[model samples]
Target: MSRQIQSRSYLIPIHLDENHWSLLVFNINSKQIINFDSLYNIDKNIAIISNLISILSKYVTVLKGAQNWNFFQNYSAPRQSGDIDCGVFVCQYANEVHSILNMKQFDIICFCETKIEDSYPNSFYKNDYYYKIRLDRSRHGGGLIIFIKNSFVLTKSVHPENTELIYLQFRKSGQLNNFIYTFRAPNLKEQLFLEKLEDFIHSINLNEPLFIVGNLNMDFSDKIKSNISKFADHNDLINFVKTPTSI
Candidate 1:
């Protein structure tokens, strides 16, 4: 199986019992065995993961070279809301993981009653992307991640030391130099959110071709909209979208 698939990672789905489904991923490049069990904790599944690793190591040791396997039970895979949904979550997570690893931009946001924990579905894994920046606060309902193409030669120019804002500088070969900022403010405290963001924008090189985007979460009637405009005017940036993104 290792020789057949020349990928650094492989997602293997297995049916455990009549109703339960789980996933096992072999990350050969990282020498890690990533196990995903929706119903069980990491410690509970370590034995199963260890046994599987031992069996596979025999066939792969000769073809893929010898290495020690590190067991990682993904507690981040979605917990099943119902017994039947485990299979569905596993399929979706696997697809998302494969897409992100292969560098296909998947913009669809999947929401469910169960919290999704796998980093691949969120495109958080540093795979084939050349330059990636992530400002993650999964608990706070605010996070931003950017993936630059591996073909692009990027030089970090304006990375802020703050997590609330994502400011990156990149220069693509034979392409115009660009500055990108992805912003996501708090839903409730709009005043302080814009103030900090405005301060951040003031500190960066705004004269270049700048692309600023994110889930600002600011309503047209909200006072934060006015502050956003004020900041835009001060920095000569344009606010192109006015419609409410959510229904």
Candidate 2:
């Protein structure tokens, strides 16, 4: 029994730092973040209820099973977003970031981080190598991001209506199943997962603009950046950078 959806779209955020100092905000469609002056008497840790008018303004709802922050699926269905109706699907591994995020809103959610990896891809990229996407290094990092389009159309794919694609930026023989995928040994598991996710995107012939954002652990290299730009240009997707860190 899937939960009912009551909204159109919701904001989903995931912060990797385990400390409560970091925040994961969801469903704030109306307002953006505000900086408050230091309060001498108030405890910043307190989770205070916002004013009713504000609460109605799309505050956060903690979910049990969401990838990244895609757990707000309880809004509505046929589950179509975008102008042409190519369905919406989001997948990610939350264990590396948090316990779990759940709701009946997301179409496909895979918890890949908790899986076993014999070795890791860490040697290739130093821990500090910065890519816009952050993958978990401690684990084999079968961790990935994918989107599905048009989930209503029935087929052999995970989401019948949507085209699913891996945002991992791998140029291989279709994810892990390709000959090169297994060579990574312990990393094979991650490769295989990527292959499966690639299958999800192809099923729908989906070509839409998608924004894949997260702590991918893979730092940005000049070539990697160029490749990403090309893909986005080909697909009509543009990269959006949050304001850069201030001194």
Candidate 3:
């Protein structure tokens, strides 16, 4: 008889920005960086951009929250730092650079379009888009719901069978949280989407480490966006960006 094989999961967010960027590999075991990479030069466009893209090619290794921190401390992949065309970075690989990364096989889901220069990028068939996307083949602009096959899933909202996702949208005036808006402030539809997303991510547990990456478009300063980080990071779900955020 074949024995059951356990899978691991990690909640990683490769904070995507159009400005100076970075790659953070968090240890699911310790809830910290196993390795990290950031842009080397922003002033020099060509050379800097070239190096950043090359460095980003490296892959990464993912661990689970239950894995002991000491083990991760002993085993880590070399990381790279650099800038790119401004899209979502891969969160799973062996070296955090120079490796083939994939997002198509996971149970993840997300929006296909984003607000571009003047309007929502409505064309779905186009390949090159403006949002933080996981891979080049995707359309809806940018976002990823990466997962290791057979790994644990975390979330509060009901999901479609065999899908890794929950919708994160803004709260309308009729909702119960409307009162809370008077006491504080209500989150944008996108911000609320993340809050719901985080809650769903936290609802499940895992046997091994996992990494989550996508466009959160949130900052620590935004009370609403901050809430999503709170729920995920509380269980050791680490995020790469902590500074004030903007589009």
lDDT of 2: 0.28
Model 2 Cα shift for residue 80 (angstroms): 42
Q: Write the per-residue lDDT of candidate 1 for residues 1-247, one digit (tens) a residue.
A: 1134356676666544434567878777777767777886456555655555555665554324323766677777678766556655665667655465464443222221122233435444546644555554443134455656666566664546653555656666565555555544444476676667777766766666776666565554445657667667777777676444422
The lDDT for every candidate, in the order shown, is: 0.56, 0.28, 0.33
Going through the candidates in the order shown, the clash numbers are 1, 37, 38
How well is each residue in 1-247 modelled by candidate 3, as lDDT tens digits? 3233222333232333333233334444344433223332223443433333334333223333223333122123333333342223222232322121233232223322111222324332222211122222222233222222223222222232222232222122332110000001122454456555545555544433444544444455545646655656565766555443222
Strongest candidate by lDDT: 1
Model 3 ranges with Cα > 4 A deviation: 1-191, 221-225, 242-247
TM-score comparison, 2 vs 3, better candidate: 3
Model 3's alpha-carbon lDDT is 0.33
Error of 2 at 142 (Å): 1.9
- The runs of at least 3 residues in candidate 1 whose Cα sits more than 4 Å from the true structure, single-residue gaps closed, are 1-94, 100-124, 138-140, 157-163, 173-178, 220-225
